[model samples]
Target: MELLLAVIPPLLCYVIFSLCKIGFQKRDQRCYMLSYQCHKAPEDQKLDTGSCADIVTRNKNLGIEEYRFLLRTMVSSGIGEETYCPKNVIDGREESATHMDAVSEMDGIIFQTLDKLFAKTGVSPSEIDIIVSSVSLFSPAPSLTARLINRYRMREDVKAFNLSGMGCSASVVAIDLVKQLFRTCKNSLAIVVSTESMGPNWYSGKDKSMMLSNILFRTGGCSMLLTNNRALKNKALLELTCSVRTHIGSIDEAYRSCIQVEDDLGHKGFRLTRDLPKAGAKALAMNLRVLLPKVLPPLEMLRYVITYYRNKIMKRSSPKGAGPGLDLKSGIDHFCVHPGGRAIIDEVGKSLALSDYDLEPARMALYRFGNTSSGGLWYVLGYMEAKKRLKKGDKILMISLGAGFKCNNCVWKVLKDLDDTNVWQDCIDHYPPSTIGNPFSAKFDWINDESMDFARREDYLPLLKKHSR
Candidate 1:
């Protein structure tokens, strides 16, 4: 036993050290993260690595797009609400369906998003040294992260980390995590994917506080790549400028804002609170403080001090949240604020004093993809990418909230231009423009045919009863 123990520890250490060597060697040349762009079976359909290499070698012309987006690819579970209609709600003699059933139905937003990512980035799993992803709300039995790791048959040595977000701002939080690991490390690849389970996570109870959640939050997600290798720096995907993390204490009053937990009172499932707007505001203030060290320029810091005293001595002019002269806009040219809710968006917009154009990507994302939670930022980036607004040197600011009662932000440096040639560029043709208000609805269909959980859905009564919205 002693001999075995000694041998194992040394062996493990050697393996880890060896992995570090490989990690750095592949740093920047790693393949892209797959988004839901192409369902066509790759040359290696059931065999993951074969397809991965195919993807890696296939996207040679991707970055050639006319515009450039700094951070990463946008993704989501295809929204379930795109098919719902408000007029149908009023005329509804039909059931008030729940989203659980439709969870795995066709055109799943998540699948397509992953496809888009793979097609655009031209990355495959075999090429990745690490897999880092997160989803808030929906969790499959075997776990999606594990499924991906296994599906890709990633290098047996590949490192994997999957997270379930408990707060509203967690998507960018995942980005922060990915950025930290990639900065000190190299060659190793990190795929930061964020998503929400709006379908299954939805509330059906009459609790007014909880009822509000049903009114807000839509489906969406985002996926981005990170590598410290020098080879990939010329196109500069996103730079890990810095990050700020802040959390607020949770209490009943505060709780009413963002949770839908199954509490003591036979709480069937899901709930919402009305105070989310204020809670989000409070959280954002803390995150802003955290985000400062990264975005604050020395000149701006000096100006902030000057503004603080000037406002105090003037005895009348007081800035609303953070003190005066702290111009985040001056520090970055783009914004990807999470579109959690209209109120939340209004709050962030007002607090940052960002103009409509500055928030156009965010609003447009919300209009198109809904509140994909953590992954929502990618959608906004795609908007910028599609619009060809991002330039080689432009900076983008991404911020989000999460169920953990936290707020987070990430900064990106545009690398190459957004080439219209990427496979996903044509997808825009399928979606309606930003003007179509109420462009989303939530529904869950029975997936007995498409899923392995057929037994679970066979007992249809309870499942349908659960959908009694």
Candidate 2:
């Protein structure tokens, strides 16, 4: 009897120890998103089609060809008249490209976003154990994270990371970094800030490829607070489940698809080559190869495998287009697609077989805010929240494409029904507008006329005035 009693106590202790270890492991993997804030620039910073045309007129390097290209791109970009630009661009000082302009622009966005985030979450800056900031085109001397630490008076031992050149996928990459850190740091809080600096990187060159950036990118940013604290679980809006990233930078074509280079005239610009769409498609396919299995339901996975083989066996006799892809709707409830541009959003939507409802947030975000680079995804998510599309237990998939020919995607489980209007406060009601057409094409389509003189600025003044009214 005594022998059996002794064994029982030790066995019980071992089972208890195993349970505790498993509990701790699960806790370590927990990452909760408490709150997020998207920056809204003042009314004075709004960039309309007229302001854009005026800026183009000021650029002596551009001819009629460039003007027509810009107009065509702006008309089809899926951006609206209310998008904001840096103060320098608003003031017609784009060519100056001063360091102060870049700093001030970032300061305006980061400070406002952080301020609002703190207010909404009621979380003190001192509680932040880690800080991650991403700005693809700008990395100043002191670094953006250092600037935040100085401005917020954060703790001396706070961990800080400033990521540059990661492109639009940077925010997802930042979240992945925080998730990894959460595994080692218990009960920790982290803040992530994502934005792009347009002032210094504004392309003055007439390279048609480079000028595309000017028409598409705009001023915006976002700040998010995340925590692994079990106490804050109820307060979290979403719980990040997984993140997957794919990069094709080693391929020659993909590597050169999007890059920052100096034009023949020694003017710096970001070039988007014709190969970009192909590169993005390839990267997305590779990323989904790993990601879909993790998130898709078992039956959905089986359906995909069967369909894939069925198509492969009939390859020679099959039609031109590949048959329908996996049904993401089976598992995901909401999609926060990055609003890179009109064509990008359209292509991704078609490939995923998403409904108009799934594509609305991306389209509306692009129309309302233009492309804010890494920060763009958050704006799309904000749109979903404002429309009250998110519900408790629903899953949201976020997909972001970046310059390294990289595609980064992640999934979030909504903690509750979120209805924050965020940066879309004044404009959410009018979203999914009747149409996203811009006035640029109507006013400047005349530039495309072969008979029109390409060189004289004075000759266009009367037309410009006529269109202005």
Candidate 3:
């Protein structure tokens, strides 16, 4: 009887251990977005409309209508005066920089951003288990992965990946890749860097479709640190809850919507066709069709299903299906829609039935920083953080459209109340202004040179003189 009692206790302990082992192995792997940093270019690179017109006219490749389209697009495109240009491609340069110049610019951006991020998180370079980077336009020998490794002197066994040609959605793609790796790597760290090499890819060609690239693509990058280390949850900013990706490259028209080609004049440029928004909407719908079922509240999903069935299956009157319209706010608290362009933002917001408040971050990011390609979503998030709009348990939907007709969506839950010190600290207070619209069309009499002089005398002179050495 004594032997039997001892066996019983040991067997119970074994059973408990086995159950815990199974539970731990089966538990979902959690990925945390610890922190991110954006590289703010120097002020000299700001390209206003007048400078853009001068550059286009000097290129001598575009005709009158093309120039007019660029100017009109610039005015209504949501890009403000703060979008930057590479030093080699700034106004009056006559020629954009060579491939090596692009490499140099990217090197500086990537290094600086990573340095800032590490300093912020206090995560050692040696602690990073994986390195993933995405740059859409340029790829050289030794690869960007090699450059990062050599620059940071990361561990020799650290796995590295350099993703190219994926375009703007590449950042989330890199995030998804890192999340998948975290499943096996245990409590390890991954660094995802997204930036563009714009100098070499500048189009001097006459193709109207191709020239759109020159006007919209700008210089920027972001570095993000993600980890599966549960101990770091207190310091982490967000928990990645869901990731969804859809690729429609098989469709011929969608595939050609954004493509890189050598123009008739043999100048290389990316062609962004007019049909891009329509194709992107379709792709976004397909992604959400799968994603909404998983993340949306039950009633919201039922409403969408009922509306969809009544319109298509029940042959009832379908009012909003004729255009983009859906009440996604019922499920999502905040959205980080890709600020690819003004038209794209408008179309996606309309399709999703998002209010102006829901879109303020994206619009403000575009207005303040132009499209930063793969890093654009991070800028939108930065704007939200800067404004202190996020709250714990709020759901943030991050969606981006890229080349290869791709749509990527990631859902995140705010882990805690985020601090105000972020990338947008310098300009947050100046934004989401008293009014919101196309900055070019908006009339502000008080902002003229005369009014500005009065403000300088009344407000700025004392501060300037006090601080001036």
Candidate 4:
């Protein structure tokens, strides 16, 4: 009788303990996003075509060929005139950008974003248990997270992480980091700030490959509040479901595809080699290979497998120009692709066989904000919210490509129907404009005439001024 009593009690206790552990694990894994704020620089910082042309004309390093190349790239870049740049760039002092300039640029954006996010979420700085800040081009001595802690006077024991050189994919990577931390830290709140310092990293060199970034990247940032606290579920906007990251940096070509290096003349710049597109495509394929199985419906996976085998048996390749290789629509409701460039957005849309509606947020964001590096994805998300496309039970797939030849993807499930226009509020009505064509092409087509001496074209000033309006 005594032996039976002891054994039965211990066994029952063990089972209860195991069940409790499992429940706690599941709870810890649940991460919720409360709100996000995207920074919009003041109107004075906007870079229209006329201002860009004026800056180019003042640059002594650019020759006629370089001017024409910049014009061509700008026209085809899909970025609109209202995109913002660093104050230093606007002042025509990019080459002389100091550490203070970089710090000032980041301070303006990050502080404004964090302040707005705190106000939106009503979350005090003291409540933030962890901080993760990612800035690819500039890392200062105090560190960005430290700057936040100092400015906001956060908790003394809070965990802070600063990520540098991760490129445009850094935001997703930061989210992934927070997800992992949530698994260990019970009921914690995290803040993620994503931005790039454009002032110090501006390319002054004449290398065509290195100069593309000058036209594409602009000044922007975003701050997000994420929490694993179940008590705050009612206030959450999106729930983190799955995250996948693929890095192909082991390959030499991929590693060198996008790098910051000094040119032959010792002028530092970020070089985008011809191999970048190839590297991005490969990384994306590898990432999706792992992610699709996790998020796709079972029926979709089965159909894909059956199709593959049937194609093999028939000795035929899949039909040409088929909608995505697999029906991702069966799983994902919306796509928030990185607006790295027009080509990148188009390529992702084609590969996934996404409809024009699915790609509109990305295209519109690109036209509105240019590429804000890691912060760009939030702009796309904001556009979707402004358009009121996200609904409860909808799943959004976010894909981000960056240097280190990395592809990072994550899935978020909407908790509620969110309609905050955020940064796109001012111009949301004008978006998906009648046309996204660059007015620069029409006004500056005369620059392509090789017969004219661009350097000595003072006579063309009147024409430039007339068309600038």
Specify the highest-lDDT model's number. 4
- lDDT tens readout by residue for model 2, 1-469: 9999989999999999999999988877899999998988999999987788777777888776777787888888988889999899889898897999999999999999999899888889999999999999898889999999999999998999999899989999999999999998889999999999998888898999999999999999999999999899999999999899899999989989989999999989889999999999899889998998999999999987887788788783534333247788788888889999999998888777777889999999999899999999999999999988899999999999998889999999999889988777888898788887988768777776776665576776557656744
Tens digits of lDDT, candidate 3, 1-469: 9999989998999999999988886453889999999888877877755455446556766544454466556667778766887777774553656777878889878998999999988999988999999998888889998988898889999999999999999999999999998888888899999999888788887788898888788889999999888888898989998999999999988999999999888998899987798789999999998887777888877786778777777677656734333456666789999999888898888787787898899998888888889999999999888888889988899999999999999999998986564768787878877654443343221233343443523353333223221
A best-first ranking of the candidates according to their lDDT comes to: 4, 2, 3, 1
TM-score, candidate 3, is 0.87
TM of each candidate vs. truth? 0.67, 0.94, 0.87, 0.95
Of 1 and 4, the candidate ahead on lDDT is 4
lDDT string for model 4 (1-469, tens) is 9999989988999999999999989977998999999999999899998888777666667766787788899999999989999999898888899888988999999999998988878889999999999998888888889888999999999999999999999999999999999988889999999999998888888999999989899999899999999999999999999999999999999999999999888889899999998999899989999999999999999998998899899898866557547889889999999999999998888777888999999999999999999999999999999999999999999999999989999999999998998888888888789999999889888877666664554555555556666
Report lDDT (Cα) of residue 155, candidate 2: 100
Q: Which stretches of candidate 3 lie over 4 Å from their true place?
A: 1-22, 26-28, 91-96, 306-314, 321-327, 434-469
Superposing all C-alpha atoms, what RMSD in Å does each candidate have to the true structure? 15.9, 2.5, 8.5, 2.3
What digit string (tens of lDDT, one per residue) describes model 1 on residues 133-206?
Answer: 67655566566667666755767877777677455666666656665666555666666656655544444333
Error of 3 at 62 (Å): 2.3
As a TM-score, model 4 comes out at 0.95
Worst 10 residues of 3 by lDDT: 460-469
lDDT of each: 0.54, 0.89, 0.82, 0.91
TM-score of 1: 0.67
